[model samples]
Target: MECGIFHTPYMRPGRTDKETFEYSMMLAKAADSFGYRDFMVGEHGMQAWENIPNPELLIVAAAQVTERMRFAPMAHIVPLHNPSSLAVQVGYTSQLLQDRYFLGVGAGSWENEAVLRGQPGDLSEAHPRLLEGLEVMDKVWRRQPFTHEGQFYKAAWLEAGIEAGSVDHHDAFDLKDGEEYHALADHSPYGGADGLEIAITGLSAGSPSHVLAGQRGWTPVSFYGGSTLLRSQWDVYSAAVEARGDVPDGSRFKVARDVFVAKTDEEAKEQAKNGALGHAWSKYLMPVYKKYRILQGFIDDADVKVDINDVDLDYLADHVWLCGSPETVMAKIERTFEQTGFRYGQIAVNTHDALDDPAPWVESLRLFATEVVANIEVAGSKSPVHEFA
Candidate 1:
């Protein structure tokens, strides 16, 4: 399986934006040097914990510092911006990165983000808006002059300057007799003949995003969801693809997980529970998860009897996180593959802030990259693990 890093950069308070960005760059460089295939960064507007409103900027910067690692916005929240503007930006970034860029789009999931944008904070319209936005972007990328009059957004580029001949006026600056005017330049993504790859992420069971991924032949990303949700996502994705007379390729599916590796199972567990991962979950993510009522899904999936309130770091370490020695983490990955019956092509390690001292955090990444990844197999074939000199 291909391994990568998914960075939300759940940075705690008190750090400058520049500091946060540099930290992300550090992770990107590390992942790239470690032979990761891709690096995904999240976009959030309102939340301080998950900062980095425009992940495209980060990806652009990351592309300069790292070679061979592809980059994408874990997702750009579609409902939060004008689709036309976003389309141009995405196109420009894709052109800049060439083959190293893909697009990840999402309907806004956080209610506060909606409220911050002066909306009702209801996500009922988010999905529809997302679809409309994507349609607008698709039209833009096709290099066609078209008009869209959708319920959420209206866009038109039906007139081209080239279609109208230049006026015979001497006032025109530096105009030659034979000088020809041109239409708007093409702003399509740069991914050779197949076009740019679009990835959509799903966190809940029976997520429509996965179905949409299948229908559009975009990459399907399962983000930090448990076994049940993973299976459900694959089921819906595969069903949609088959219904459309297309085969579902597991190689396009990406599964993001909170992972950490140490010298031993006990050492990894202690670090994960007491270190940055534990603090981030307790202080930031758990509250959001509780607010969204997402814990019940995990509870039901695990068949646990603990109260949602009581679900602490210990619970997460035991049930959710792949924290252990290389051997133990490999076993967990193998189990997940067997349980879901889907040999997902990519394993995106959900990254967290390393906080003050970066030794343990960096060590975890090194071990995961060098050791755990080397011994893992996907679909009965050993991975081409990189050998560090």
Candidate 2:
């Protein structure tokens, strides 16, 4: 039962971008002092509404302030960029962090990003393109010169410059010019063998492709819904890995979600209920739900009556949020653990995250770590609870 913080900064219209950036880092540093396992950040670029455009830069700054906290860009928009170059950037960053960095890649969204790049829909469906991207990217990181001539891009470059004077140009390859494949592998900003960890997400439900991910032994992640969903995903993926008779690096399976905590149950509820901005946020999100799937209630048949277009403030306050006083939060936290055995938490201590100010949210997380998490961990409780996982 390890705990950690996770966030997407919930780019509200009123919050200043700089304030958002500072507040995010501040929370990261705070999470470190509290002995959190990790501080993960999400990335969104070229979107005016989503502030934290580049998570890697933020992680670099966060790394300077916190000593104990492990940090990673929760996910990087990989589909839009040059895959090989992105891999190199990851490699270089890993080197800078002394091999502390991990890479989470996903196909790009954001219509503006695609339009700016003159693309259509999303690059996620182009599975072969994405696969080729990872192949070339990993080869570059390992500094292994391999020729690729499948679909997307082709290259024959080695880590060593020109394979010791055997080739002189980019197109020059041993297969063609009677020289082994070669290229320059330098310690660039985010490239080369400082132990780069690559995790590809969205493996699809129960698909055999998931077994391939298990083969590489990289972490897999998914969003949407609550804790049970994450645990089940990890279990299925882990089981598949085990079925292959390969002992996975057990730590690779992770579950993440937005969380906020407070000192007392009363304060926690007050902070969350009073911070009704979640209603406003929900208004903007209803269509995405309609397009995909609706949110079902979690635990104990908590019925919430709210219109899709007009999410009830009270309904969201009670149903969607995982905020409460230490005792209450502990109960919910314990329920989550007993139900799914999820070991990580992405605590959202920022005020805007709960439609409140920063102070209350931060206080909540500190109290949770001190009281609730402490009790459960110490008691070694094994109370069973119902869960979707």
Measured by lDDT, the strongest candidate is 1
Candidate 2 to truth, TM: 0.76
Instruction: Write one digit per residue (lDDT tens) for candidate 2, span 1-389.
Output: 34555555565666677777787778887666666655667767664445676777888888888776666666676556677777767766666675446667665445666666566655544455566777777666665557777666766664354444454554533456755444445654343443466655442334333444676666665543444454556566677778878764433444444345566556656566565335434544445434433344242224545545554544544565566666766666555555556543333232245434667666666665565555554232221111101
Q: How far does residue 334 in candidate 1 sit from its true spot (Å)?
A: 1.7
Candidate 1 residue-pair clash tally: 0
Residue 89 C-alpha lDDT in model 2: 71
Q: For model 2, what is the alpha-carbon lDDT of residue 360?
A: 64
Which residue pairs collide in model 1, if any? none
lDDT of 1 by residue, 311-330 (tens): 98888887678889999898
TM-score, one value per model: 0.91, 0.76
In model 1, the worst 10-residue window by lDDT is 380-389
Question: How does residue 244 of candidate 2 score in lDDT?
Answer: 75
